[model samples]
Target: MVFFGDSMLETLGRVVVFLLVVLVVLLASLLSLFFVMLRTKRILFPNFVLFIVSLLYEILCRLLSFFRVDPTLIDRVSVEMRNALNYTEFAATDPRERILLLPQCIRSIDCPARLDSLEGICCVECRGCAIGELSARSREIGIRMYISPGGTFTERILTRSKPKAVVGVSCYPNLYEGLLKAKLMGVPAQGVPLSAAGCVKTTVDCEEVMNKCKIRS
Candidate 1:
């Protein structure tokens, strides 16, 4: 009985060591991928490569969570990873194939945009908020624009519009989810994180979206 107990302890120690080794390896790979992305300011890889990189990033995040790290830190890392995905190609996508998705939180507090059954925000260009400005700019570029409240609404809009590519603007949490959704759908998607902070009455960098839209123009 004493021998058996000693052997079990040894086995458990070996397993722990192996797991630690793996954790270190994964962290190193994730950091390496991150540095490469930072240096290039873009992923510059095909979808296959991007998928692998994103998987590594997500794995690292999960592993870090085991350490009880702050959730916001993980979110920030996710946002940075999402941003480095080299949307250069997506820039040139056909306007018909692209959709610029904005968040409802970006609307003016008193704005009166109505929603339709098809998940469309009927913005009469009221100029009540930046959405109007963005909507008008997107129209000029001949790209479709809509306001999605969250992942579910964005999913519905994607299904209804069936856009080939998407550019979403939102806070880090929602933006991360939307980007993941886009990847799952095999749609080329990019996101812009809201510069301002908070859940409501937030603002986005409209110029960045316009620059992306102009990539195809």
Candidate 2:
């Protein structure tokens, strides 16, 4: 019994050490990949490599478990991966008080597809897009989130809200407008360009927004 207990302790120690090493390696690899992507502008390649690495790592972990090899290392890797993925969702600071959300264009009162701000408008929550979710989250965090239809209304909202920073989601034109506003107001701001993939509503990941708002600690 004494010998068995000792062996089990040794095994546990080895598993812990192995898991630590794996976690460190995984983090380093991800960081290196991020830097390479930035330096080489090889966006698609890095994304592909990350996917492959993640898949292979999971498979290896499963295989190890099938052979009764301690899965602690794999489990650790999974947790780390999840955390990294979720990191984008985490706001590094409680700057909720300083953040704002704005919309690029307002919807037409008659047609959902047609955007019209010729008369100056605002998002009406009629399209059921990310604006609603972002508003809710901002409310929860005490941040000011608004959906202004035009630059004029956007400035109005910003002035009333008196935010120290802003987060805008829109197309290139609106993004540029928001940046200009930020500069003029001396407020820090960030923008998320809408992609052609049409993920404006439910598909928008709050994690991505969080990533944009993340501050290095």
Candidate 3:
């Protein structure tokens, strides 16, 4: 059975080589991520780094799920990664150049808000939910805001508004999607994920959004 023994050894060698290559690639990516964090104004590279890390974390999430652990660790890592960026760079930007994107799911499912075509959500401050309250505050701060249900609609808003920075609120996956798209457009972006995620009645932290806006009295 020497032939069988030699074949097994050969298979083990290939597996070892494959694993070494994967380890080397992951180490390089980690080093690149570290350097990007050290001086993030190396703007373009940070976006690419974020994309790569996102893919890595997505794989980790799948592995975690296979073990029946919390799969949301992927989203958590992604949120932290996005938050680690320098938000203050856009602090002094004009309000017109900034947009706050609110998912329509943030509204009460039975709420009477309507789409205004150009404007995102037509709100009457019914006090049914945080939508009216946030709209009022965003107006006071002079930052444009939209409450969009997903579709070509949000993309249309992006095209028309052409924001240089965005404060978006949605579930983690949707938030991540927006970040990647904003990166492609060379827009600085951040987000607050919903406290709960679903097709209906998701909620966000209004206080956190205000903090992001750095709103004035």
Candidate 4:
């Protein structure tokens, strides 16, 4: 009995060491891919890199912080990678089957839009901010637009609307979460990162958004 117990302990120790080695290898590979992407603005082995990023997201961020690097760098790269991976499917969806979600922060400070339980913010196109122009363009292409009040509202919109594809504009962190959510829901989504991020009076690149919205061609 004593000999069997000792063997069991040794086996467990070996398994733990193997897992630690694997973790270190994955972390090193992910960091290498991240630096390459940053320098080249190109993704290599995108799906593999994304898997590592998702698997070690928290730990990787903490590691970056320890090295005095901006942790959100990985988040930004992951978002871009997701966009590239989903672009073909997203572009194939019909305009009518797509929806555009804009963050509430991008709205003008004096915006007159009112929030509803069902539809979120109702944009009246008062021309107060880029949203009005975007709303107009979305209408021209037969795509529905929503100004999300928060993450919960965004989920509700997706659940209720059930669009085939989505175009979302937000900061990098929110964009990363939103993309992952869409993927889990079996929806293809394209994200446009906000040019200036803030709680209120934020700014987005309206032209870049329109370009993404019409990426079908």
The TM-scores, one per candidate, come to 0.75, 0.44, 0.75, 0.92
What is candidate 3's TM-score against the reference? 0.75
User: In candidate 2, what are the lDDT values of residues 120-155, reduced to their tens digit?
Assistant: 333455545555556566666666556555547777
lDDT, residue 139, candidate 2: 64
Give each model's whole-structure lDDT.
0.73, 0.53, 0.73, 0.91
Query: How would you encode candidate 1's per-residue C-alpha lDDT over 36-116 as one tens digit per residue?
Result: 765776643334444554566567567667767644454555655555563655655786678988888877878788877
Model 1, TM vs. native = 0.75
In TM-score terms, candidate 2 sits at 0.44
Q: Whole-model lDDT, candidate 4?
A: 0.91
Per-residue alpha-carbon lDDT of candidate 4 for residues 80-158, written as tens digits (9 for 90 to 100): 9999999889989888899999999988999999989899999999998889999999999889999999959888899
Which runs of model 4 end up more than 4 angstroms from their true locations? 1-7
Stretches of model 3 off by over 4 angstroms after superposition: 1-49, 215-217
Clashing pairs in 2: 88-211, 89-207
- Pairs clashing within candidate 4: none
Residue 168 Cα positional deviation in candidate 1, in Å, after optimal superposition? 0.7
Better of 1 and 4 by lDDT: 4
lDDT of 3 by residue, 44-121 (tens): 354565666665766655656877867664454465566556365556566667888898887887799877878868
